[model samples]
Target: MNLWGRINTLRNQIFLGFMFVMVLVLAAVGLFNYEQVSVLLRSNAEKHIQQTAVQATGKLDVLLRQIDTFTAQVATNANIQRLLMQEADGRPINFEERQLLQQEVRKHEAYTTGIRSIELYTTEYRRLLPLADDTLESRVPDEWISRVDEGKGRLIWLGLDPRYPDVVIAIRHVRLIDRSFSHAGYVMVQIDKSYFELMNAESAADNDRAAREYMGLVDESGQIISSDFPSDIEAAALISRQETISLDGKKYFAVQKQSDTTGWKIIILTPVDYATEGIAVLRTAIIVSVMVGGLLFLILTFILSVMITRPILNLIKAMRNARFGTLKPIPVTSATMEINELNHTYNQMVVSLNELIEVVYQKEIIQSRTELKALQAQINPHFLFNTLEAFYWALDEKGEEELSEIVVAMSGLFRYVISRADEDEWVTVGDELEHAERYLKIMDMRMLDRLSWRIEADDASRCVPIPKLLIQPLVENAILHGVEQRVGQGTVVLRAEPSGRKGYTRIVVTDDGPGMNEDKIRELYAAMESGQNDSAKGNGIGLANVERRLRLYYEAGTNGLNIRSEEAKGTTIAFEIPGEQGRD
Candidate 1:
């Protein structure tokens, strides 16, 4: 055939065939490029989040600690006490001394560098200015005085400053400390937004030179202490980024930090577009490259007829068979590892679908987790409360002081069951002792009959906050089932001794009352393991709730309850709860 006739014969097949080959080449290249780009982008994003959170926390800790240290020093200053002493002696500062004292107070304010306002307040409703030439009010606010009333010598952290926006902060009311400390007044200092800038490492520059980022200093109340975001951005309803909030008509990714000393929450916002912008760039690039390649293939359509058409047809057939689970390889296709490997992978995916489908459906898995939390909520609180109310009503009707004390014990029991503190779940052993004492005292008040309770706490466990309400419930439960149920004022001995440094706080509550028999003792063990209720013996929800919270918060191997009982003898409930919810 002539060249023209050959070209005409092949034109229809060749046109589409060459185009198809070009498409294959483009797709393979795009896939390779996409994989590399995606890995790098994901890795970078993850690292950035980890690094920023770590640095921000460290910086904040140092800043807050410095403030605390300075505040402590000022609290104990001799001159502050001297002025307080003179007032105590019914001697007032001479006019010059008053001026010097005022100047000194002003100097302290200046030294603070980040304080917005400072004032001296007296109960006589008198106000004095420390900085004599102050640009703003030197007197205490009406509310500040009310909060500081007679609360001298103690630090009272007040709420946000209503006058300032985003600059809401934590204020401490310290009554003058010491016997000679006069009731002259309290010093109120307003913390400034710039105080947080101390965390910045740069040579202290004008605030304008600070980073062009949205930074905020929050006090314990979770209000913004200050922010670099426009005042308008601050106006957005304070919402967490983990939730969603709109800004400037767009979304943003954000993070939050709750301050340790003040309980303030600091939030940082990044434009949502900024967060997803990288993904958008990669997506756009891939699409554009594929489109450009596809257009280029259109120009090569009129060449390479039979060979190209055969391979392309086989590729489509192979893809179809792989998807349909037929594993139909194109009979006479390209001899290429890449195409064959693609077929192999597709076939394996189909083969494994039965096994992997379970993973894909998360409904049951998530439902179980949710149910576990719900179960905990249901079992712990409900059992304790119902039993306590039952006890309280009995006390009221019978004029039984014994019942009242038991009710009090029951109330404390509930408190401990539910109280999860700000940072730790458990309170200290000493706190446990205090709560247990309250429980026992209420019981003693009720029984009126003498039920003696003794506590022996090791020196170290005094400050260790253990799981809340742990000690009392077991003690009261012992009283209810053992001591009070029997005749006479029962004796309950309480002891907590730290075994070792790893928060090994052991608590034992022993009662001198008729204890359980062998059958009943076995039942108690059964109740614990199965978490079943035993109405005959008083080891109901209080003991169960205490054990559950401790086990939930403490390290598994270290937490549980122990009970020893004898027929017609005494009973003791002993258990070990981690000193501080195992967090410390």
Candidate 2:
């Protein structure tokens, strides 16, 4: 072949094979560099956030513990202990003794000068000797005095300073143990919230000059306890939850630190951008290196003149014959006798191998279909046994009379779910509701007295068509997870109220069980959407499957399912399906 023809031939095979190989090399190097740089930056951001969270919390705890310890010690003091009992027993202190006790309280508060700003709350109850210019109105309310008297020592971290709104802070009440200490009412210590915010921000601000960061001390409720940006601070209080809150387009990695002294949580926020600043430079360098390397390889392939032969032309012709019709024995009558003979023999062997390959392909397809049916079969038997057990429970636990009513309802429900009668999609709402009631009866047997349920359906909604066996799975999830585990008695209410357009129906399902937190509920919905097995930890795949079927079968009826839940409270599951049914 001529030189230009040879170069053109290279384009016909795998895009000049060398360029294809070079692209793969470039992609691999780019991916490796991206991963390493990305991981290092993410790790640094995470560790710095964790470190600052632990440190700021540690200092805050030290400060809080100092107050608690001092308060407890003050409670046990001889004068205060005696005074508390006298007040509890309704006895008045003598004038000579009252003078000595007040002098001692003043001496003790001097030692706590660094820890708290002492404020005298009452004229009759007690006095902060040094801070007292004149007797002031009682800051310790009668309600607080009553709480201490009732023997409630639990100190809660109150979020808002009843008096101060702009300041981010926390507070707690300590019941003085001494008789006079109790009579003194309670002690109020003022803490500086800024001390914590400044200390926390310092550690995360270690790297780049322009990268900005914010520090927040939030309670377990996801409420900001001491943050300059109280509105921006998201609290993950009762549960140690963490989420990224983007502000002005910057990502802040927030870590939660729960305090031991007080039930407050300290969250430290750091800028993720600062940690990965070096990765951008590394990415550019890798791109440049790959381009230079690819050019060098193309030059080498051209110089080598890797074999171009007429012998391969005969081989290509044989390949075309095998594809176009029944495999033919290659021609051997050529001037190049040796090359033609080899091609003929190679063609004959390919005919035998191709026939064998066809046989294996057919067998594998049949086996795969069989295995799929077997998996479907597996789901039914477990379902059968579980159903039988539930019936047995209904009879024994709630009495035989309720059993007959449940059985008749369930028999009709099962007939519809298992039938192959309707090939045309779409079943009535009444049909889906019958299925849902059957599932609820099973759970009602288990919960017995603790279970109660209600279903409301408008006459208009019952005529609306829904995908077969849709509502049953969702009801099963609502009871099994929502109500069954709840401590107190539970209630599940399902409503099929008519909503939106004339033919549309809004179906809602809710339960009062041991509720789930926001994180867990989102996790529940996300897992179902992805078709993952969430059953291991109280997640059921049924709801997700039903959702997929609805979206696929019903072209544009409703957008999606809505799941809302709270921890130890309950959950609400709702979806809007058009009153008119099927995958239209």
Candidate 3:
């Protein structure tokens, strides 16, 4: 067998159909589960990382507040305020006041763990304390002084000291504590960068060090002030505002929290693989389950296909034996009810077929005898045609020309009606029309002025082939039923023309006689379809026979006979036949 034959078999079709349905159901369930779990895992990871960022920012804020307190204490000391008052009065500061100021600054430095230095400068940009590198003018830029003045006694965080390079700095404007609260000088505090590493240490203790998250601190401007992972600072800077980022072909989730005290942000970047570690195990489990289930299902499907097709195959074998004239019945072997019923039905069919064979053989003998009688009957028509020819000659000799033409038409009509056994059932449209015309001529002589007929056909339409005797029956039905019952003179017209449909020609038999109502026409069609002769309605065996022959000869889906009539108007009956190109 070919590929289609193999697939079309009962066994393979059942197996493949079940397998396809099972696989589709499994795939839909598996995909839905995987997506739901993945979303849950990622959501939990994001929430956990967000909490960690908030905690780290809070701790950093507390440390910064402590440094601010220490700076406040030094700036508010009475000795420092008195010294600034003396300097504003144009009195030079003594060596003892300078020593006291230096001691006060060093004293506050001991309060903070990461404090690198504390320095003070006059409004003129001259160093006031920490005289180790004494110079006439301080190295502090005027821009720094302007920014500090804008602080208005509040501490302003300046990320990463440009001069020191190893520390982050804060600057504040020092004001007198007395009633004036006057501007004195500027105070600066620098803290070492190692202080920011506390967050990393705490995170590493909570998680595995190998998969621990990296933390960084950035100023309001997104410039990196300090980070535990110094080498990744550039990548971290680019993604400061993003929740997740990709770098070096690896993905990371970024979490951020901004401090209210220092106006700085703490950023944490956790590797995506570490966060979604559980998803891999779940995916592997699902894949293995699907594979094992598919294999088991395939085996089960094969076994069931065999069980179902075995009995069917046995039935097919018995059918093949019947094809060879064995006429043997099959045994009922299958346990299934439907299959067993099928086997029982087949056995009954085989028994009935044997009986039918005997009956058909007897009928063939009877049909042969009937055909011989039919052959004997065919001789009468030839004898009749010869008698009619003799009558035509006698009438012509007696000066009866009209009656002679009638006799001649009758002779030709009888000859056309007699079909030879070897003659083709189909005839050209022109020949069939000629036969109908002869019949009409004979009827016209009987009716005198009561009936008239006309035929309309183009040359091409007349040459088309159609089943013989088809048009004449339609014409006969119209004249006998339609024109014969009319009160006045009636006209019957036959037209053969192209039907407008491809490869078809239309034949219409129309009569200008008393027509039928819708109900009467419907009843006429119903009688024709049921093969009943409606004698009371004047439509009998002739119309029914023509309708049956048209159906038998024409292809399906093409238009058949269409009858149109009204109570007062004439009736028109039209039907289509295949053209020359459509003929087999």
Candidate 4:
């Protein structure tokens, strides 16, 4: 069968409907749980990363404060201040003063672990301490001196000096701790970059090397002062408010905390995949469960559908046998109550069908006998024709020409009416018009000057086939009811021409006689629709018979006969006959 027919079967309907509903439920439950788990896991990951950022920032701030305190102690020392004052007076630094300043600088450097070196500079940018071998630049940058001045005794953090890119520097403007408290010199401290890596090491001690979180310190200018993931500094520094960001096409959650003392941001980047790894496992489990459950549902639904439709299939097989003239009844073998009821109804139907067959056979036999008797009683047309011919010759011998003509016409009309059997219903338009003319000729002869008639037709329309005797009845009605009732002479015209519709011919019979009123026309139409002979309406029976025969012979919806009349003007009756190509 076709697609619709296959889908319409009871087995497929039940199986598909059950599977559809099962899949919907499974999908809904799986999706709802997956989304809930995803949201909860992401929220927890964010909170955890945020706490890590805060802790890392706190540790770095503590280290920075300790370094600042150490630098402050060195800048405020009495020996360092007196030496700076003596240098400001343009006095040459003696061995004693230089030795005392060097001792003070060395003493403070030993107190801080990550400090590379400590140097003191005069107000004129001259170094006052002994030069260290690790120092890259002998002279302090003018930019550093200007920044120290801007600090006005407070510590100034200079992140990643180009002159010594391996270390971060902090500077302070030193002033005399004497009665005047005048400006003296500057103190600078260099801290090794390795000090920043300790934060990451402590935070990620439990994590594997591949999945460890990266921690970095960025200055206020978005420059990386120090970081374990230095290559990602540019991408990480751009993250401000977003919880997660993509770096080098891989997803990472970013959390940041700003230091209150140093004014730098401490950034922590954790990989998104590692944070949500458990959620991925949950998603996989949901998918596998749905697939396994769907397969089980499919198999169980198919089994149930087959069990439900088996009895119906058996009923269909029995019905098929009955359709092929087998009147045997179906046995009630199913345990289902509805199936048993259906089988019982089918058995009753088979019993009634056999009884109907018997009754139809008896009635057919009776009808055959009645038809045979009627045929035996029918008169022969040739016998009537010969008798009418004999009367015509007798009248001619008595010099009754008008009467002989009427007899000849009468014989032709009778022959035409009875010539065809029931099967031979169609006749050419020419033959039908000729038969109508013969009938009209007889009426004309009897009425004399009071009756006149004409026949107009084209050769094309005359050859077209129409139902036999369709034209003659109209002519008879026009004469008997119209012309006979008129006070003066009346005229009847018959015309055959192409109809307005393509492939059809119109034949109209018109009379110049007293016409019918609306009520009379309605009565005629009622009699025609009822297929009855109303003898009180003089010509209604003939017109009704013609209209009925036209409707039965022609295709349905064909305009059979149209009657148009005025009170005293006349009446016109017209109808169309299909052409050869138009007929069924």
Model 1: lDDT equals 0.61
Look at candidate 4 and give me any clashing residue pairs.
none
lDDT of each: 0.61, 0.62, 0.77, 0.78
Error of 4 at 497 (Å): 1.8
Where is model 3 poorest over a 10-residue stretch in terms of lDDT?
132-141
Model 3 per-residue lDDT tens digits across residues 203-300: 67765654656777887766677776547448445545776887666777887777887778878878887776665447655776567567666777
Candidate 2 C-alpha error for residue 287, in Å = 59
Ranked by TM-score, the better of candidates 1 and 3 is: 3
Q: Write the per-residue lDDT of candidate 2 for residues 1-584, one digit (tens) a residue.
A: 46654544433443556676677667766666665675566665666667666767777877666666655555456775565455446565555555555665556666663433543233245453333444323443355445444544443334434455433322233345533233344444454455345353444455335576565566544556566443643354323454565656777665667777556666655666764466544656567656767666676556434433454665676567777755666664433444555677777687887887889999999999999997786556447646756786777676786775666566655566665434645778887786777777867876778888988997778888777777877777777787777776788888898776676788888898777887887787787789766543555547778778777876586776788777766888888876546444
| TM-score, every prediction | 0.35, 0.37, 0.42, 0.44
Q: Residue-wise lDDT of candidate 1 within 308-390, one digit each (tens)?
A: 45555676765665555434333332454344555566557666765566665776789899989977876566677778888
Q: Which whole-number lDDT from 0 to 100 does residue 48 have in model 2?
A: 62
Question: Mind sharing the TM-score for model 4?
Answer: 0.44
Which ranking of candidates, highest lDDT first? Answer: 4, 3, 2, 1
How many pairs collide in each candidate, listed in order? 21, 25, 0, 0
Query: Candidate 1: RMSD over Cα atoms?
Result: 17.8
* Evaluation by lDDT, superior candidate among 1 and 2: 2
For residues 1-584, write the lDDT of model 4, one tens digit per residue. 46664445454656676777677657756766666676667776777788777778777977888888998899888778777877888896877787888888887777678988787777766676664332313545667667778778889887776677788888888888774667787788888887766365445675564576677888776777777674634733454788677777777888778888778888888888666656544766577667767766677768776777787888787678777765888665565556667888989989998999999999999999999999999998899999999999999999999899999999999988886465566778999999988999899988988999999999999999887788988888888778988997999999999999898899999998889899988888898888876443554448778888888877464677799998898999999877863443
